[model samples]
Target: MIATNEKLLLDALPQPVISIGSNRHVTYANFAAQEFFGSSLNVLRRQHIVDVLPFGSPVISLVERCLDNSLSFNEYGIDLTPPTQIGGTNNGRMVDLHVTPTEHEEGNRQALIVVQPRSIANHIDRQLTHRGAARSVSAMSAMLAHEIKNPLSGIKGAAQLLEGDAGPDGVELTRLICSETERITGLVDQFEQFTETHADINSPVNVHAVLE
Candidate 1:
């Protein structure tokens, strides 16, 4: 009765779960397992687990180790082929699988396998690439601002001093100097806005909408 209840509980898990017998036959597969492998549970029942999974897959080797030593095996990077009709772009995806020995009423050696897809590492990699590009652009803008700002300020100040000494002779040149300085200052202000706008803001936002 306990073994039967265990089987029911195993089948109830949301993640893909399977039970393999000593003969390496798939004794049980949950609904999620059927969907993930793109086959019905009835079709997989009594079939060898290796028949569905590639022979060279890490998951296959892990299951073999668990059955051989009667010990549990936990591994990441198990690659399994999705059925062609499922529209999977990649040949396979990375997953974490755990296998543990379980005792049955019939005294047959069996193992329980639980599977979870790996996603967090890929997400982190994408975010890091985006931030690296943003940082490079910010650094270049800052360098340009620093290189041009000081020389423009000196030219404007010298023009003002010359105007004070030249009476009416250099009024037009002084006015031109002030206008050019203001134009350069406006450009510098625009660059400053870019650096300021991206300053470590932490606000909750719908990421999907932001991406769109």
Candidate 2:
């Protein structure tokens, strides 16, 4: 926990604030910091900074640099996406990072980090990507639907004609062909759903239920 006055000040700021120990473990995380990392303060406190940041993140290096030289650094457009995934409906956030050396009671190097979230940039990027994918899906669905349905119509008509002229067993086979073509046509129709629009929101989620 942070000291009373310091905690109040940090929590009041819109940007995330974190206090990291010499060992790279979190000492304190303000309210916004929890939301920034997609984690709780308790989880952040237990884990090393490297555990939360993406692999090869520049932020990690900056933290180390600040600790080693007792210097302050201000960086822009830093990506804070999780290692497992990057940028399509992202589970992570982006920010402008600020790191500075801080004093510790044990005379060890520590760091104070501030995160200025740039989530709007990610939102615009995600929307553009979604639109591009939707267009591609729509175009492919139209082309394949046009090409296959034309052939299917001919096949079904041919099958119907054969059913009239053939023996009982042959008629059953023709009917089966007609049924299969209809089923395939139905499958192709489903592709159109991808082009439909939907709302994008950060709805409240049941975390415990998901874990269970």
Candidate 3:
């Protein structure tokens, strides 16, 4: 049995971890591994490494090789699709694998496998960046509208005040000033749309219909 402190430390790690015993049995799994495999530690301990992963999986080979060679290694971009028996999805789960060979206090050879899932992590990062950029655009549009509209208002008022003092020749110049300010104001108001959000509508349609 794993000591309480050791188990706690393993559980605290964010990445999934599984320990394979010399007999190729799953000896231990951390909390992250439990969640990743969709099984409790007790359930996993009853199964062998091949039972957990597919037969002839790279992970199986890595663990066996680690035990045989007594060496640690890293493998990238391996897809260990969760077993169908568990509540895992059918989608490909790409992960970077790290295998470390070690001898414990009991003088037994053990292999540690830590799984770092890539696809989901990268997807979440991309989403966060996209949302952050959208928020920045909205804030910039709002700031620009505030700065431009205030000056435009002052200029429009000044033009109206000047219209009375001017003669016929200069009256048209005042009118042109007012009209140009109004046009620019309308353009600035259009920027307000960026601050508002609209729901996206999605539906599937036939490609042949579009081609026709």
Candidate 4:
């Protein structure tokens, strides 16, 4: 029988979670784990962790470490190749794994394993595209501003001179120049804001609070 707390923990985790006994056999797997491994809980419980996952996977190391040291082991960027279902092409998917000893009593121990994927290449591609877009927007904004500034100044000067010479009729043209310049300035300010660099502070925060 599974403990209530243990069941709640397994169900709450966002990523797939699996528990392995001292014998390296899967004792339990969360719903996410079932979906990811393409197997039901009953089928997975009957298999060994090593059999379901690739041999010598980083997850194996994590499991070994937790058992040996009786401590939690958290690893990042682990490449895990989940077992492919029959008749399915091997997608060669990789995942990150984390293992921690959940129970240890009278020399009988069990570990909780969490799985997450890290597609670094894909993330890099996305960042590069974002940078390219920012750069393009900056260049276009600068070019447009430069091209318009000189003509705008000339128009403002001419409007002012016309206002001085003509009667109230030319005052409207001067007002137009002022309004147009204000609009252009607002656009340039927006462009500058977009070009500014953003700083991300990396520190441990309460993940539960963030979720709430």
Candidate 5:
């Protein structure tokens, strides 16, 4: 009864977690794990790691390494698609895999595999990339704001002046030109603001923190 309760507790965790035996068969899969792989506990337990995971998955290699070394291992941002399709879509999550060895019996080792998905990790990567790209365009934004904006504004003013004397079609074209120039100028102004705030933030963190 206590063991069943313990298993239930582990299953309550949000991240997918599984245990792999030395023989490459899966020993246990938590609820989240079952959901991630789109399988039930009975099916998962009967399957080998390779059978569950897609072909050429790095996780297969990582699990093998952990068993061979009898050590804990972790890998980040891995694509772990399962072989079975769920609703015609891949039943896999991009995850960080952590494997720690356990000795259920003397000289017989098993490992706990923790699967943490990388959706949040990918978001951070994109945020950092956005900031870097924003920084890269700082000089260009400054140049455009000065060299281009003033001239463009002058052109817009000229168009507005001509609009009064223009035919109906000519007036519409001039208005479009003015609107486009204003839109471009607004974009350049936004790029300039991004440069001023480089978004450099510092705090205590861990790889798992990014997951949160």
Candidate 6:
């Protein structure tokens, strides 16, 4: 029977870990490993290291090397695909493997392997980068809207004031100025909406209409 303290410690770990005997058979698999492999301890203990891992995987070679050399090895960004599934679900994952060899009670070498998946890590990195870029764009758009739109409002008001006193040609010129200013301000409003973080759900735009 495993000591309470030892079992508790192993189960408390966040990452999956397994120990391989000299025969490359699994001697011990932690709670995380059972969850990762989708198997119980009894089931996992009956299987060999090769059974859980994909056939002809480099990790097997690394395990052998570690056991033979009595040294530790770390491999990063290893793409792993399990050979079999416990409940008809299996997906490939990127992981970092750490192998450490230790002496057993009978003087044989047992290798410990830690499996750390990188999918969650990669996702968090992408999310952070995306949010950072969004914030930067939003700040730039807000600054432009404040600086340009304020002066643009004054120009639009002056053009409207000139429209009544101007002659036909001057009236046309003022009208042109007012129309152009309105168009520019409309563009600035769109930019402001684009920069808003909590924007309303936008309707799908037609690519053909936009292009035309």
Clashes of 1: 0
TM-score of predicted model 4? 0.51
What lDDT tens digits, residue by residue, belong to model 5 across residues 1-212?
11477588888899898888889999888999999888998998899988988788887887888888988888887767787763355543567789888775356777788888878668578569877887768856666667878888998999999999999999999999999999988886766665653355688889897898
Q: Give the TM-score of candidate 1.
A: 0.52
Error of 1 at 8 (Å): 2.9
Cα lDDT tens digits, model 2, 65-107, are: 8888899999987778755446556654667889998875668
RMSD to the true structure for each prediction, in A, is 12.4, 9.8, 13.0, 17.3, 14.1, 10.3
Most TM-score-accurate candidate: 2
* Candidate 5: residue pairs that collide: none
lDDT of each: 0.76, 0.81, 0.84, 0.74, 0.80, 0.83
Q: CA shift at 131, candidate 1, in angstroms?
A: 17
The C-alpha local distance difference test score for the whole of candidate 4 amounts to 0.74
The CA-based lDDT of model 2 is what? 0.81
lDDT (tens digit, per residue) of candidate 4 on 1-212: 35778778887877998888888888888888888788898998898878888767777777877876788877765645665543355344556677888764465788888888666796567569888998888777667766776677777677777777766756877778777876776676565454433234489999999999
In model 1, the Cα lDDT at residue 209 comes to 100
Steric overlap count per candidate: 0, 0, 0, 2, 0, 0
Using TM-score as the measure, name the better of candidate 3 and candidate 4: 3
Query: How many clashes in candidate 3?
Result: 0
Candidate 1 — which residues are off by over 4 angstroms?
Answer: 1-3, 83-87, 120-212
True-vs-predicted CA distance for residue 70, candidate 5, Å: 0.8
Worst 10 residues of 5 by lDDT: 85-94
Error of 3 at 14 (Å): 1.0
